[model samples]
Target: MSPFPFLSLLNWAKTQGRHSLPWRAYFHLSIKDLGYHIWLSEILLQQTQVERVIGYYDHILEHFPTIESLANASYEEFFPYYQGLGYYSRARNMLETAKIVTEEYGGIFPNNADELIKLPGVGPYTAAAIRAFVYDEPLLSFDTNLEKIFSRYYHGNRFRKLTQKEKTLLEKDFRDTGISGREMNAAFMDFGSMVSLNIKPSDDNKWKKNTKDYPLSDCLWLKTHGTLEIREKKKKTVFPTKDASIIVVLHENHRIYYSSTEGEYQSFLLPPTENDIRHAIQDFFRSKFNLELSVRPIHDKYFENDRPFVVCNAQVQKGDTLFAKYRKENGFFVENT
Candidate 1:
């Protein structure tokens, strides 16, 4: 959303960013492989770590090769492939979603967000990711990195942050439709994850502060202390926050998977689970340490395979519509909200 074509810069650097993981090769393949790979990768990511996902990714790719093969696969047969991935639900969802794709969508993943979100595991981030990389649907994806970007951009602009009406301007920056939105959102996220600095050595550091790019780093303050302190060293720089308070936030789409880093913004395909929150407790050590944890936007698979997802907020309920997510508005990622 910068006046500049930041996406081009990040995409050019995608091969070298913090997200420059080996598993992303799955993205370069055909859409069929891309979707399947993304699905398999997300399932695995939800339950396991990145390094472990690499081999598991290859194994899943080798065995299933396509959605149909996976749809036809049984959980008894599929569970072993995810042995290292501790999250059982992720695997179950993979199988269920694959089957759903086979039975409902004719064995091909739907290129649209509505149909994609209907899949067992596909949430806002995952569905948008599928649309971006495979279908080129242009839906914007929000993740850890993006949350930082938006939070920084909207640092003091709480009018936009607190309600839906003000956030719509953000859509002009990364609307959900086409490759441009994907690139903008992806780049925004990557910028935060990679380029942004993680000054916090541990999550327990309650005081962290970071500079944002809204109006060229005009925003540099702590959620705890407010913007009264801190020096403006430069624009778009991530610093340390050992005792500062206030973290970044990202927009959560209605019906999209959501779980943010306390005051920071991050999105997930599946809603974050209690177990996931239990595990995330450890990450807090670092969050508190960050003077400003660098939340750069670089599009790479942060949530894939079997990592846990965001804890579902008040937004989701039975018979929820895709658009329903838009209405619930956590005042987080629903940029429109």
Candidate 2:
């Protein structure tokens, strides 16, 4: 794939009598607003309408004011900022992610893609966007909007299915445009919006408005080719996307849970009602595993109702047997062991 000529596209837009919008003002009021801009825009733009994000963007700036402030803010503080934004989880995730960035990463915007993605609610696209904007990482943020622009530019078909190969090739092509990383980010988004607004999609138009080389619903060469391949594998229903991976959590109760279903390990709130806690316990232990699991709370009392669990390095007496310790205070027995 040839370079996307992103700088040329920018020049084309400029010569056509459009000047680059001040990305800073649109995104940030000041450097203090940088983190606010990134975090706010990332959440607001996720699966949300652009028209709706505009006002909420301003509202968030009015509230948090700074990245450090956002980091220090409680979930309650951030939740109010998310009133009109449908996803309540984004606000909470951002609050948590911001704190981790502040506490662990020393308040510097993370440049590592893996580290950024590990933050709450961050994914490939969001992580790439943050790295590009903050560190000029030259990474492409491939989202549905950018995908559409590529579909119009190359597919010629009414509907284009973007294969993983195409996405990889497109990123490679756009990177060579030598445009600023931010421009590459903005151009495809603007181009996609412009294509929809200025030109109507139809077969009668003869691909004039669209620049696709492929015949509609026909095989043709594409600019980018993704290396992703499909393989047959067993599929099962799970709370979120189902993969082979599994997470197990042993609660303080005698119950066990597969962590995949729970939102997060710490997301589980304590101080639940007896019924709620019991229900959670029941749910975990209810799973298909045959081996027994139990939580043995560490205790100080010798005659405690719990069996005597060996803690630290304590040698059992000569007469001590598994049977005797099993009934001792301060321990709980597990059938698995």
Which number leads on TM-score?
2
Q: Tell me how far candidate 2 lies from the true structure as C-alpha RMSD in angstroms.
A: 14.8
lDDT of 1 by residue, 94-188 (tens): 88898887788776678887878878877878777776655655455655445454554445321223234334545544453223644454455
* Candidate 1: segments with Cα more than 4 A from true spot: 1-15, 18-23, 26-28, 156-163, 175-182, 200-337
Candidate 2 lDDT trough over 10 residues, lowest sum: 309-318
Model 2 agreement with the true structure over 188-247: per-residue lDDT tens digits: 555555533223223336344353422222212122221121124789543221111112
Find the number of clashing residue pairs for candidate 2. Answer: 12
Assess candidate 2 and give its lDDT: 0.51
Measured against the true structure, the TM-scores of the candidates, in listed sequence, are 0.53, 0.55
Of candidate 1, the 10-residue stretch with the lowest lDDT total is 312-321
lDDT of 1 at 1: 27
Candidates in order have lDDT scores of 0.50, 0.51
Candidate 2 Cα errors over 4 Å, as ranges: 1-3, 13-23, 26-33, 197-337
